[model samples]
Target: MAAGTGGRGRRWVTAASPVLLPVASAGLVLTLWWGAVVAFDIPRILLPGPAEVVSELIRLRHRLWEQGLVTLTETVVGFGITTVAGLLLGSAIAASRIVDQATTPWLVAFNAVPKVALAPMLVVWLNLGMQPRIAMVVLVSFFPVVLATSAGLRSTPVELVELARSWDASRWRTFAKVRFPYALPQIFMGLKIAMPLALIGAVVGEFAGGNTGLAFVIRTASAGGNTALAFAAIVVLSLMGIGLFYAVVALERLLLPWVRAVTA
Candidate 1:
């Protein structure tokens, strides 16, 4: 009984310990923000208080929800493309030394060009709809996935590979049973990195060219100098990013339960 109770207590402490510092820090920042608003006599147009922002959020709920959905769709589509292409490309490159070497310079050149500069060209080619936005998100995100997957594939234990060789495992069987599983943690690491970049890319693409989404609302509100509305849209966009990040974390938990146990 005592051992069980102790284990439960330890588990609680282990979870809460990590959360406490960040939560306390956030509280401190919010308190400072409230104080600064009063101390500086900040104008609403210049800097809305947290309460005002919350109120604006409530007021704009419907519009925010609609725009948020559009942004989410773009994020999902873009992230899907990035993951699929990255994995395939990573596998192909990892499986072939010649291909990896031949493509390295071209890949470097592609990554070198600023994505924003190409956003205009994307809009011209794919039009101003979801295609351009998805393309931009994929462009911003896939590099990390490719790099991480390649690294992970290379990280396979030589002993394990030799064991598979001794068993006369086919190349596809070896990859499926050993290399891909070994790469999953790194792949998730890449996903965590890609998620926010995808969100930002979607928003940037929308801002540059799209007729729909939170970015459009932000642009319109800013142009009208409706600072509160613009600020409200910005806040909604931030929340969307947060929600997407947590969604990825949740998926990581689900798809990689082994990761959770090991990480824990």
Candidate 2:
């Protein structure tokens, strides 16, 4: 029992070490901010102190939660679409050099198009609804997944291919049993990248067209010159992005425990 407790304590200590510097840094920034607010008598419109932001957060907690749900749904739906589409397309391209050659340029072109610029067109085509938001997220996310997974699929060691062939494994068997497993880590890498991109896309779509969400709140707050409220919304958005990113990472760790153990 003592050994188990010691192990957990050590693990906690290890995790805390990495976080300490950031916590200290935040403390310093808040102290300076409070000092500035007092010394300069900074207008709340220009720069609200941390206390005001916290008060606003408490006051608007329920409203923020409702808006957060809308944003979260948009992110999750879009991320799901990108994951399925990317995996399927990546597998297809990886299966055939001809397919890769034919599709690579088109994929590049699609990625090159600035998704933010397409927001207006999306709104026109899909209206100011969840569809446009999800589409934006998918557009922002799919490229990284496809590219990373395809690269991983193609990167199977030649010796591993030869070994599979020596075992008289069919091409499909080789892909299923060998190459795909080898590519799991890279697929997760793409997922990690796409997760945050999905959230950003959703927010951008909301900001450009939607009437609800934290983005809408930010817009209303900024227009009304409620800088504190706008900053609060920004803070919530940042927290959501971070939380989602870590959720993806946790899923990766759970699904690929061997990968984590080996990497660690």
Which ranges in model 1 have alpha carbons more than 4 Å from their true place?
1-10, 16-24, 260-264
Candidate 1 has a TM-score of 0.90
List the candidate 2 regions with Cα displacement exceeding 4 Å.
1-12, 18-22, 39-41
Weakest 10 consecutive residues of candidate 1 by summed lDDT = 44-53
Please give each candidate's TM-score: 0.90, 0.90
User: Who wins the lDDT comparison?
Assistant: 2
lDDT score at residue 64, model 1, on the 0-100 scale:
86
